[model samples]
Target: MADRITLTGLRVFGRHGVFEHEKRDGQEFIVDITAFLDLTPAATSDDLTKTLHYGELAELAAGIVAGEPYDLIESVAGKIADEVFAKDARLTEIEVTVHKPSAPIPLTFDDVAVTVHRVR
Candidate 1:
């Protein structure tokens, strides 16, 4: 069985949007991350090194979101997945979900989201 660790609803201010106004002002984004890792060693030994530190992952993800200005959420999510893979080679798989709060649309809606998964 795959012991998965998850970080959800990580909020950050990022400049990712289709329009200039949207990009200039920026908006709040929510990110959800899932990492497939074996936690047996950590559970048995009770060592932080044996398991993933979700807070560190969250900070890393936030740095990516705030650092890159992609026009599409798909691109953002893809980059996030790539970043995660680059950081942790041990992760069997990684999933990223990005929520765009200020998406341009005709009708009223909550937000739009994009999810991407990568495996090593």
Candidate 2:
């Protein structure tokens, strides 16, 4: 298995939902990304170029989450995975998790999330 670079609990605000109020008012969204790649090159060479820059990855994921609107968190997670593939050719796999805490559910809950995995 490849080594992993994981970024967790990135919070952002977006207007994404099936309901009109949710779309208009917006809500907070949390994102987590686990990117799999060979860390041997970076570890051996001690160079930043040998691996993906996690800060940039987080910014990209945050931009995707805060920029556009999607009815489903699954779609959000998939798009994030696609972005990771587009940006990093070295990554072998990626796991994206989108969390919605302010979802308009009438009942009580801790949180709601969707996770998507992609491999290259």
Candidate 3:
């Protein structure tokens, strides 16, 4: 499917990092999701039941980010992908991006992010 549904810059506080202070203090995490599906059903039927609900997807991402403490953003993104696949069977493809603005890096940078793309 060429149609895409995208959610960007979703902020959630999470204790996910390699350092102890990072896990204890916690930091903000930004998530972006792009899900691919056939929009024809929703377009023709004019019913939300025919399409993926974005609000539920956001909650799933937030729940994962706020629930567990992972040492890597890769793991976080992977979990998000797993949730997306589990939540809806109609989704043909999904891309999840986890952004860490307050990483424990000594050097200055704009942001650090991990993006995972999955296809069913």
Can you write out model 3's per-residue Cα lDDT over 1-120, one digit (the tens) per residue? 799899999999999999999899999999999999999999999999998899998999999999989999999999999889988999999999999999988999999999999999
Tens digits of per-residue lDDT for model 2 on 1-120? Answer: 559999999999988888988888999999999999999999999999998999899899989888888888898899999988998888899999999998889999999999999988
lDDT of 2: 0.91
Cα lDDT tens digits for candidate 1, 1-120: 379999999999999888998789898999999999888988999999888888889989999889879889899899888988887777889999999866778889997899998878
Residue 61 lDDT (model 3) = 96
lDDT for each candidate structure: 0.88, 0.91, 0.95
Better of 2 and 3 by TM-score: 3
Model 3 residue 27 distance off true place after TM-score fit, in angstroms? 0.1
Count residue pairs with overlapping backbones in model 1.
Answer: 0
- Show where candidate 3 strays beyond 4 Å: none
Model 2 Cα displacement at 14 (Å)?
A: 0.9
Error of 3 at 63 (Å): 0.5
Return whichever of 1 and 2 wins on lDDT. 2
Q: Which stretches of candidate 1 lie above 4 Å from their native place?
A: none
- Order the candidates by TM-score, highest first — what do you get? 3, 2, 1
Instruction: Answer with 1 or 3, whichever has the higher lDDT.
Output: 3
